[model samples]
Target: MLQEKIGGEAAVDARALVKTFGDKRAVDGVSLTVPAGSIFGLLGPNGAGKTTTLRMLLGIIDPDSGTRSLLGHTQPLDASSEVGYLPEERGLYPAMNPREAIAFMGALRGLPLAEGRRRASVLLAERGLADWEKKPIRSLSKGMAQTVQLLGTLVHKPRLIVLDEPFSGLDAINQEKLEALIRAEAADGATVIFSTHVIAHAERLCERIAIIAGGKVAFAGAVDDARDRLRPVVRLQTRAEDGAWRAALPPGARQVGREWRFELPEGGPEPLLRALIDGGAGIDTLSIERPGLHDAFVAIAGASAAAAMGEGAPE
Candidate 1:
């Protein structure tokens, strides 16, 4: 079990969450917890029921079975004012100007129209959309419109923000901007839960992550803990290849170019290092590489999930 870090109650919690559509189980027994003031990622491939899980947690859809608590409210709607959700389906009135669009969304979340408009103007200016604040959503670029929508989600100053596929259609520059915004929100003591098929985004921004595959939680914990599932790898370069020194290598050690790469044994690298030095192998360089989140995801969630992420899953 993963221990809660932020004290008090969890910002968001779901237990054995289940959802179904006809005969197909869209989400099966998914569960996750997000600590307050932390960036938590729900990572999975497309159509992996990530959206379904998020919707259920937000009270946007009823789960077939299971329980959820959002911002300490058993009924998510009771805390709706404190929660902000940006769905996978992006929608904004094409005819509405950026400021109007933002204020409208905020209004739906129970913010006063004047206050929403005020916050919208400030957010638009801060996000470099000041020049286009009066322009209709139809006139703005896709990236710019998406930014406006995200600003709307924040206009009400929600304590818990849930974003679904937030980086789906963003360019490199805009994606970086969004990442910074998420970090800023967490820094301001808000809990951010974002779902993404892109592994790199989670690897970069998430302190904790729950990887879902085939509608199930494959792994859930701190990023470091997930990566720790795999052993550290050792790469050594040596000029000596004598019979005595060969015995010092681990069982699975293999030569690739000038380096011998192998997984460090369970006893640790000290034993291997000692044997190599004692055997007089002319070691030029030795380095241990820690496994990354991508490796952990593949090892834990299986290759199919990794493959589904496709180009979005960066090394």
Candidate 2:
């Protein structure tokens, strides 16, 4: 099969991309493609270069090396019109009202002033902020401000949306609402990529994820595929009791608290099942506990972190 071009079937395609600051390499060499109309995640711990990578995609900063294509345009700033971006910092002018603020954002993206206001009106109403459309931005609560910021990002109907920690200030209710909005946007054929440190948001929203560490993509692919690639580990437990069963487990298992989990590297569950039975262990229950996104995140980034520290992972 032929390899797809960067953004060939994607909304954002970045290859061997790099950005540096003085002596520090902020984004080393990272390549990623976010498929059109899907929610993609870029994740990492602090200073892992996710923000820099995003900036390069947004054309806010030039990459020291490599290529990036967004929404059928390459290199030049005009390609930016195809995107909507919500930065990590809350960017609404404290004094500007929602109508003016959202419209200003649209204008930056080349929307006509009147058109931007028209769209903001409809989007604000749809987002349940209709009553506050004329209210000063500073008067709105954090959650309400977040809603308006989102309105600004989407008012122009860009084909792609890039959000940086979009849920930062939201309460649970607003978080759910915002997530629903994101999904709705994606369903309407907009590609979405959001960078976040919170695991749950990524787990809930992203179909594909890229784990970045020390300026590299530690893991990249569908969420399920990444976890499955790690191992098919199952946890067996008896009645919620904590004991020395971990020490008695087979050499292949890694014990977590009161559970024993392991992947049958070459085979299925039969050998492990037979071993459990043959050992005459108290078998209250057996369950295949698939690795959560957080687990995969830690495992993937952990190695990279160790590599950056110039030593193996701590014992």
Candidate 3:
């Protein structure tokens, strides 16, 4: 059994969540765990089975095989009442006012009608939609509608929030606000599982995440762990005219713009200047270059795919 975190319960847990469409395996052998009060990001390239996994979790679709539990409920629908799901496809009644629409959604989440209305009003005001509370959905802008969708998902204060592509339509201002909301939710002891193609969002908001590709997990764990796996090196600068040499560099080191940059692979953090001098690639200035998450992602998933096809052969 996967042990839950301290002072926490297992809010979402799955073991080999498998699903298929005809002969295509959508979510094949996907197992994940989301502890209470943490932000877990589901990341992948387009059509990498992200949506399929989420759908299975939401009970909107069922898996061909495997088991799942959310909030202690074996049946996803029973668990769903305790979940707030924001799908990629934005759906809203354009004619309904924010107050009305959100209340309806809250009621579905098990909030009493009267309490739902009260919560909707407070939530709308908190999200800066107070001025537009009475405005019909059709009259609102795309970002506003997106906000309403988020409000509906959250108005009932579900313990688990599953947000898919939550930042798709928002401007920078609203994006910041939405991020705040996500962080706040976790602070208040909610378990959040959000998916997105945008790596930075996950990198910023998630304590841990799993990257899926071709219906499998390419990487999963804490943000620091992911960074360590990639091991982005740092770059150093030394000028020939202004300076002499940086000194002994490692293999795969390159000199650019009067500075030498070295790629420090994992478990190989040496005193950079000494290494440069020892390698005979000495320079006046030294810079260490580390690969960013995007580069690491491309390197791992792309290399994995290539190796499978025997194309580049993981070179």
Q: What is the C-alpha lDDT of each candidate?
A: 0.90, 0.80, 0.78
Give the root-mean-square deviation of each candidate in angstroms: 2.0, 4.3, 4.4
Candidate 2 lDDT tens digits, 230-299:
6656677755344444444557876576666665435567766666555566667677657777667667
Using lDDT, give the best candidate's number: 1
Model 3 lDDT per residue over 227-272, tens place: 6666556566543332223434457766566655556645465665
TM-score list, all predictions: 0.94, 0.86, 0.87
Residue 162 displacement in candidate 1 (angstroms): 0.3
Ordered list by lDDT, greatest first: 1, 2, 3
Residue lDDT tens for model 1, 1-315: 563758576898889999989998989998888888899999999988899999999898999999999888999999899988899899999999999999999998899999998989999999777999998899999999999999999999999999999999999999999999999998998999999988889999999999998899988889999999899988899878675777877788888888888888888988888888888888899999998889899989888889988933432
How much is 158 displaced in model 2, in angstroms?
Answer: 0.5
Q: Against the correct fold, how does model 2 do in TM-score?
A: 0.86
How far is 282's C-alpha from truth in model 1 (Å)? 2.3
**Overall local distance difference test of candidate 2:** 0.80
Badly placed stretches (over 4 Å) of model 1 are 1-5, 241-243, 311-315
